[model samples]
Target: MTNSPVASPAQTAHSTGSICEFQPVIDELRRALNSTLKGKSEAVELVIACLLARGHLLLEDLPGLGKTTLAKALAMSVGGRFARVQCTPDLLPTDVTGFSIFNQKTREFEFIEGPVFSEVLLADEINRATPRTQSSLFEAMAERQVTIDKMTHRLTPSFFVIATQNPVDSHGAYPLPEAQLDRFAMKLTFGYPDRASELEMLAENIGAADRDRSPLPAILTPNSLQHLQDHVAGVHIQESVLRYLVDLGTATRHHRDVTLGLSPRGLLTWQRVAQARAHLRGRDFVTPDDIQDVAAPVLQVRLSGDFESPQTIIETVLNDVEVPVCS
Candidate 1:
């Protein structure tokens, strides 16, 4: 591993930290994806933020809502290798992590990498796969490595999995187990586009003669992305905000609606995402507001309940609990 130090002192200032140098890169990515994504700037930003934080995303929405498109756009924007896996009921664990194949010529078992080896992997209709097949990703998402035949193979540095599932219908779908759901850093819903945005999309399609004509261009290379990740890790997070994040995670465990709360890993993920969001906004340090802004998406799926809306439950809990003041 090569260590290249990037200085960010402006980020060390008090209250108002300096903006990250990668802000321009983030802007270019947003512009590149604007035409293809139409009208969801917030959703696009959240996805990019997750990627910068080195976290996985879980998109739960109705079909044809551009879940897969967003994943592809992110992958393209980073110029990374993209792979799509159509998970099914009969899909096996070996199919995802790849099985050892015997090479007759070499007379030795060779491991052939699967789609999971790519930088960006889109697991479309993930719920369609059985629990066994779905669990296959647990190791890859958590450890960034796949174990087969007692041997482990490390995945690419920018390995990310964007999983999409249809929430409207559960028929022929196996709900992801709790442990698997915990691995996702954030869960997002891409609702139907508003009338104006929908109209804009129609007009663009009509003029281009094809929907894919103006696909988003690559704005950053994989190396640059890894650099951004390094920058995010260096972003300064205040002790007050850190305490608040810990308090928030502890509060979730005691919430009435939640049977289980965000784990320590989930809390760390939340902290990292908050820092990433600040970096995207050209800031070098995190704030309470940043924590609040990212708390919903970071903890929504990790904290579960039998409430009407899991997202609503999280929001309510966050709103009701008082954030501890740092002395």
Candidate 2:
């Protein structure tokens, strides 16, 4: 967590896992997530990468897309306690980070835990929450700890937040402050499904309207998942590829449209995310392509600029940088 991701993930990483040992679980996770959100294999790949990378994700899209479903599926696949919070204008800070209440019988104040205690948390319509309430998650997401009433509470080391928000241009939506956005590693969208995937979904739902489908069995225990994360953190990156990542980061900082460019911390997050992408592609070494593939979404959420479309800035930066050749 010291902004040097090459040495470790967000936390200390150690594993007794080999690639062969992880294949089955990774495939199971892929199937479960892919089925839950159909016709989004590309997005599914990114979601898995984010999980293995041990990073939070921000999902921005229109309503009724599979944002909620995808969040649920990811939690279920990871085999963890999942909590959902429906953000609203009136949500209080204590409502998210929990509050202290007196136990009448013992006469001692009890600290009630909130959604941040869960391994996977879904913040639905996050922009609807007031700034103070949203700020409740900042410490938890970044440092894996929450301070309440001058006492610090530690969350699960594997804690991951998947926050979804409607487009900023939508009515009643509040733009997230840059500090909040920087906490997330990637921002993605689950766009509308293709025709075939939609038809299959409708067919499957026809007879199951009132039935609650059993979730997929846990493909990985916490230990196993930790091992996969360790593996991703250990994925090798060539010196030239590291330089390439730095070059891309510099481009963002120097861009004319960028008001607040990618910070050093964001650059470290980018390094970890790119490592996850390489692991997902079954590679032990990072490549220039891995960095470029994740550039758009990883940069989109954190970069503050005057540009209307974040994608345009990503394209321009990617175009401006020269790809480094690995020796």
TM-score top scorer: 2
lDDT per residue (tens digit) for residues 1-327 in model 2:
123232222112233444544555666788989899899999999988888888999998888888778777777766788899999888888888898999999999999998899888999988888888888877789999999989999998889899988874557766689988999999998878999999999998986853568877766656657777878899999888998899999999999999988999899989999998988777788899999999988998888878888899999999989988786
Tens digits of per-residue lDDT, candidate 1, 153-188, equal: 999877999999888888899888787888999999
> So what's the TM-score on candidate 1?
0.89
Error of 1 at 104 (Å): 2.7
Cα deviation of 327, candidate 2, in Å? 3.0
Candidates' lDDT values, in order? 0.80, 0.83
CA lDDT, candidate 1, residue 144: 91
lDDT, residue 197, model 1: 96
